[model samples]
Every structure is written in structure tokens, then in C-alpha cells.
Target: MMGQLYSVGRNIEAKVMKFVSKALIVSLMGASLLAGAAHAATTDKKIALSNNYAGNSWRQAMLKSFESVGKKAVADKVVAKVDVFTTADRAVPTQAAQIQNLILQRYNAIVLNASSPSALNGAVRQACSAGIIVVSFDSIVTEPCAWRITVDYNAMGRQQVAELARLQPKGGNLLEIRGLAGTSTDAKIHGGITEGLKNYPQFKVVRSVTGDWDQTTAQKNISAVLPSLPPIVGVVSQGGDGYGAAQAFAAARKPRPTIMLGNRQDELAWWQQQKQDGYRTWSASISPGISSFAFWVAQQILDGKPVPKDITIPYLAFTQENFEAELKAIPKGGVASKDYTQAGAIAIITKK
Candidate 1:
């Protein structure tokens, strides 16, 4: 009777072990499937890039970066479709209409470079209501429902003033070269510069010119106004205007001021040449590849990943020490940029 009891106990233990091993295998398989679902969630999604403007070199570079990334993701079956639409004019209404069209087309996601911060809120709201993801970069929208990849334009402006103070202790008259007049980027930077000037009262902005963020436009505007303005000790510009500002000063036959640069290849090359003549200044710009970053952010959202509504992208700055090396890395006729990979975008989103 004791031997019978012992045999029964051994049989029970073996059956329990077998059950536990099967349960463990099933649990592992379920976990693997969950992981796969996270990555494959967006494979059937269609994404669109709703660009408001592409008139400048930076804009062109941005489009190219998005194209490269978008094409690869489509080919790899990461997303079902990727399409681009740029308004011929940088008008809020045009973009609004475009957004409406995109909604009608039933795009799963829309990556945006908005024409205005607040003007497009209605369209953006409509998109959100339809269950589409909206991610804006560069010139971003102000709508609460949209995700923004923003730059600290205010901080950038303030830093420019601080850097100028260091470069020129005895501050004099300054010429402020602005970007596209109606953009949030323009407004924020101008506001920051105005605010920053409160601390550095010795520096006075004597005149302001709209460059439209283009070389020829900047040169034309600066040249037309240079004769009327006071002697500028420094020219603070909103990128893409630096090299053109230099040209305007040269044309006017005036003494060259310490002009702050944007990270265009031509601007960097011009700065490199001037460094030989004892000229000194710094360069900074938003990476054009931010379009690609925005693309991935949109994709990740479709993957059901949690992301912040407001995400700030770092502005790339080049000092006198680093400009030469950076210049070598940038392609001619393009702005400084670095494209994003899937892993890279995930890392950025995770960190944020």
C-alpha cells in the first residue's frame, strides 16, 4: 500500500511539470506576437507630407530628405503609401484646402510644415476628428490636437544676442534680417531678440529687413535699405540671409559687420573665406532633415506609441571652432542636415 502511494505521487508530479512547461512556452509565444504587433502596426498605413512652402534651399533640402526616407519606408513595406503636397504659395488658406483634400483622401497620417501657427487650427482639428495623426515640424501649427516638432526660436534669438555681446563688447547699431514675415518662426525669433535686447541695452537694432529666407531676396532687401540705415556693427540674421547680407554690405561699399550666419553651404563657404581676413561669427539652423524625423514620428503614432504633443528639435549651432569641419560635411547648395532612421526616431521619441 505504501509503494502504491509513492507511484501515485510520482505520476502527479510528472503531469504538473508537463503542464507548467507547456504554459511557459505559450506565454513566451504570446509575448513574441505582442512585440511583432508593435512594429507591424503601421505596415498598411498611408502617410502624407503637407508642406506649405518650398521656395528656399532649406525647404528644397527638407523635401529631399523626406523623399529619401519616405521612399525607403514604402519599399520596405513599413508604410503602405507616402505622398507629398506643397502649396505653390505660402498661404494659410491654400494649406487649409490641401489639408481638407488630404483628409478626403483618407491618409492615415499627415506630416506638416504649416504656413501659420493658428490659422490652420480648424483644418487640423478636422483631421484629428477623422482619426488621422498630424505631426508638424519646422514652421509648426499651434493646434492642441497636433504633435509639433519645434525649435526654440526664442532661445536661438536670445543666444544670438548673448553671443554678439561676447563678440562685440562695445555694442553698436545692429541690422536685423528676418525670415518669412508671417511665420511663427519669424515672430518668435523677433520676440526673443526684442526681449534679449532688454538685458543688452548697449546694442540697438537700428533697422529690420525681411529676407524671405532666400539669398537673392535678402540681398535685394538689404541693398535697398543699407544706404538709409546707420552704421551697423553687427548684422543678426535668421539664416539663409547671412551670405546675402554680406553681399549687400559689399555692394554698398560699407565696412563689413560681424554678421551671424545660417547653416547654408554657401553661407558657410563665405564665412570660411572671411575667416582668413580676421572675420569672426557663428552659424546655426534647424536641420532640414526634420521632415524625415516628422515622418517617423507620424509612423510611430500609428504604431500606437505614446508621444508628447509638443516635441522640440535641437537647433544645430556651429562656432568658429566647428564651422570648418561642418562646412566640409555639408553638400554644396544645401543646408546642413542629418536624416533619421527608424531606430533613431524611436530613440528621440523615447527620450522625449
Candidate 2:
């Protein structure tokens, strides 16, 4: 009787162990399926860039960064295809039509560097309604449907003045070099610069010129105005205009002033030369590489990730003490930049 009862108990134990093993296997399979869902393949997605303008070195660099990442994404089979299209002009109508065409092309996503903050809302909404993801960076749009990637440009402008106050403790007249006309970026930075003046009363902006964020244009405009302006002690410029401002000051035979610089290769090269002369200044600007970051954001969104609507990146800043390394990091003709990968994008999204 004891032997029969023991044998029956052993059989029951064996059956319980087999059942647990099957349950364990089932649980693991479910977990694996969840993980797979989280990283849904983006291999079939098509993405395109809709750039507002390509006239300046900054925009050119922005496009180059986008292409560098985009091509690699294609080659690695991370995305099916990536394309770029630049509007001939910075007209809202032109870009709107361009986006409408992209929509008709059946692209899964559209990356935009918009011309206006609000004017592009109609087009952006149309894209969203068509189930196309619109990711706008740098010159971003104001539409709720679009994902925005940018730096605190207003803070950058304010910081420029703060840096000026540090380098030139005894402030004097300032020549303001502005950016492209009728854009939100120009207005935000300008507003910050104006607000900064209130904090540092010693600096006075006696002259202002629209540099149009182009070196040649900046030089011409600054030269045109230099003859009539007073003895300026500094030039507060939007990026891409600093090196030009320096040239204008030299060409006009005026005394050199402390000029805040952008992170262009030429700007850093000139800064390096000026550093030898004990010319102390700082450089800061939004990285053109934000294009690549934007690409990843768009991709992650398509991957079914929950990304924030507005993402702000830190500005690329350079100073007299620590700019040479970054200057060398950038290719001779390129801007200082950093690209993003899928992992990098995931890290950012996870944190958010």
C-alpha cells in the first residue's frame, strides 16, 4: 500500500513540473513578442526632407548632415528610402506646394525646415491628416501636428550679450547683425537681444543691419552702414554674420570689436587667428546636425515610439579656451556637428 501511494505521488510531481515548464516557455514567448512590437521594423518606411532654403552655408551644412545620416539609414536597411527637396525661395506658398507634392508622392514622413512658424500650419496639418509624419527642425513650424527640434534661440541671443559683458566689461556701442527677414527664428533672437540690453545697460546698440544670415550679405550690409556709425566697441551678430562683421570692420578701417561667432569652419578658423592676437570672444549656434537628430525622431515616431511634440537641443558653444578641438573635429569645409543613431534616438525618447 505504501509503495503504491508513493508511486502515485511521484507521478503527480512529474506532471506538475511539465506543466510549469510549458508555462515558463509561454511567458517568455509573450515577452519576446512585446519586445519585437516595441522595435517594430522601420525597413519599409520612406522619408523625405522639405527644406525651405539652401542659400547659406548653415543651410547647406544642415542638408549635408541630413543626407549623411539618411544615406546610411538607407544602406543599413534602417529605412527604405530618404530624399531631399529644397524650395527655390523662402516663400510660404512655395514650401506649401512642395509639401503638397510630397504628400501626393505617398511618403511616410516629411522632414521640414520651415520658412515661417505659423504659415506652414496648413500644409503640416494636411500631411498629418494624410497619416504622414512631419518633423520640423531649426526653422520649425508652429503646428501642433508637427514635431519640432530646435535650441533655445532666444536664450542664445541673450547669452551672446552676457558673454560680451564678460569679455568687454566696459561696454560701448554695439553693431547688431540680424538674420533672415520675416522668420520666427530671426524675431525670437532679436527679441532676446533686445531683452538682454535691459539687463546690461552699459551696452548700446547704436546700429542694426539685416545680415540675412549670409556672410557676403552681412559684409555688404555692415560695410554699407559702417561709414555712418559711431566707434562701435562690439558687434552682436546672429550666427554666419560674425566673421562677415569682422571683415566689414576691417574693410571700413574701423577698430576691431568683440564679435560673438557661430560654429562655422571659417568662423572657428578666423577665431583661432584672432586668439593669437589676444582677441577673446565666444561662439555659439544651433548645430546643423540637428537635421540628423530630427531624422531619428521622425523614424522613432514611425517605429511606434511615444515622442514629445517639442524637443530642444543644446546649442553648440565655443570659447577662446576650448574651440580648437572642435575646429579640428569638423571637416575643413564643414560646420561643427554631431549625428544621431537609432540607439541615440531611443535614449532621448526613453528619458523623455
Candidate 3:
């Protein structure tokens, strides 16, 4: 009886040891999985924004929008950091050197507002060869491998000219305010304006000036030229200078001609004030929030998602009927009626 009892105790001890071993193995596996998940959640991604110029209010607003979006990305662990670089002189060589620096830093992606369409092509290709994603918006690059985000600037130009033609059916002298001198966007818009005016032979562009897309510059230049030119019947202008042009004509005490407006809060406010005097006009612009859109695209690519090489965003147009409401919705000094969102930017990607 004593021997049997001893044997039973030994058997119980063996069973207890086996159960504890299995539990220890299970606990170790669970701890390993938890560690792997934590590592994945903390993985870091770095992005850079390369802007060729930030000389005007429009560009300032654009940079702010990008920073806003990038801040949220960092908080959510979507990106570890976002670095911004700008060239005030708008030189192509300077911009190319910036791209090389970004590559050396091993940035996962770059969002570029190119200085020239073709000048940045080689630098863009070099970055791509080094396995970095390049996304361009606003003033874009022409490199085939880099993704592009843009509105149809040519169409915007044509639409403005068509509106001018409508206001002056009999045809008259047009004061044309062009953007920066050598940008691809400037050339495209000028081409469209030329084509649009072909149908209206009676209308002629008497004087053309470069506003450089700034309010003060537009006012100064237009004010100086008004004293020398003939009676202007209409005005066709690019963004950022419509309000200044109106102010110039107001200061001169000349009859305000039919002017096509751009998307600026001050311009819209001026229109509101003029509405009391029975003044009316149409406004359109390429949304300055496009930098935020490009930032979103870079985030998507970093996450290993598929996206289109060419993404085109449309310009926002506001008529007399809705300009007041649109203006009311935006914040003080805001460029657009709507703010950009990650989902909205993602929707721009074209599915294969």
C-alpha cells in the first residue's frame, strides 16, 4: 500500500510539470506577437516639400495648408517628419540643387512646386532612380516618372476670355494681366487666351503687363500704365491681381470696365461692396490647397498604395449668384471656400 501511494504521487507531479510547460510556451508566443505589432505601429516615414517660390500671398497660403496636413500625419504616425524648402529667387538651378539634397537625406518622397516644367526633369529622374517618389503640384515638373497634380490652366484662361467677349460683344480694347514671365503655366494660359480671342476678331489686347501674381505689384504697375493707355473697356486677369486692378481703376476715377475676377478673399469682398452699386462679375481660380493634396498623395504612396501618375484637379468657379455665400464660408485671408481633406485628395487618384 505504501509503494502504490508513492507511485501515485510521482504521477501527479509529472502531470503538473507538463501543464506548466505548455502554459509557458503559450505566454512567450503572445509576448512576441505584441512586440511585433508595436514595432509596426511606430515605423517612421519622412517626406519633403520643395517649393520654388513663396513670394506672394497665394504661395504663403499654400505652404500653410501643407503644414496643417503634415502636422496631422505626424500625430497619427502616418509620417515621422515633414521638411519644407523654398527658393525665393525662383531659379531652376537652385531648385535642382535642393532636390539633390533631399535625395542625400533619404527622404521617402518629395512634393515639388517646380520652377520650370523641363528644367527639373533630370533631377526628378535621379530621385526616382534612387527609389524616392516625386509628386508635383501647382507649377509642375514634366518628368514622366513623377506624379503630377494640376488644374486645366489652359481651360481657365479660355473661360476668362470667353466671359470678357460676352461682356463686350461689339469688341473693344482689353487690358491683359499676365502671370510670371517664363512658367509653363503662364505659357499655357497665354496660348489659351490667344486661341479664345480668335473667335472675337473685333476685340484686341492693347496693353499686356506682368503682375507677377501679386496685389501690390499689380496695383503699382497698372496704376502707372493707366495714365498712358486709351480708355479700357474690359480687363482679363490671372489670379492674385484682380482686386488691385479694380483699386487702380477706382483711384484713377475711370469707369470700371467689365473685369474677370480671381479667387481671392479681398477680391470677393470688393465684389460684395460693389454689389450695392449694381456691379457684377465672374471669378475663377486654381485652389491654393493643392499643396495639401500633393502631401496626401505622398502619404498614400509611402503606405504602399497604388496611385495615378497624372492627376488633374479642376479650377473652382463662382458666379455672381454664389460669390457672396462662398466668400462668407472662408476664413479671413483664406484663398478657397473649401479646405482640403485626406479623403478628398485620395479620391483624385485614378484607378487602373
- List per-candidate RMSD values in Å: 9.9, 10.2, 13.2
Q: For model 2, how does the per-residue alpha-carbon lDDT over 207-315 read when each residue is reduced to its tens digit?
A: 8999977788999999999999989988888888888898988998989999888888888999899888798998988888889989998987876557899887778
TM-score of each: 0.83, 0.83, 0.79
The TM-score of predicted model 1 comes to 0.83
Best by lDDT: 1
Write out the backbone clash pairs for model 3.
Answer: none
TM-score quality measure for candidate 3: 0.79
Off-target runs (Cα >4 Å) in candidate 3 are 1-43, 165-171, 199-202, 329-334
Clashes of 3: 0
Query: Of the candidates numbered 1 and 2, which has the greater lDDT value?
Result: 1
Instruction: Estimate, for each residue in 91-127, the C-alpha lDDT of model 3 and write its tens digit.
Output: 9999999999999999989999998889999999999
> Which candidate order results from sorting by lDDT in descending order?
1, 2, 3
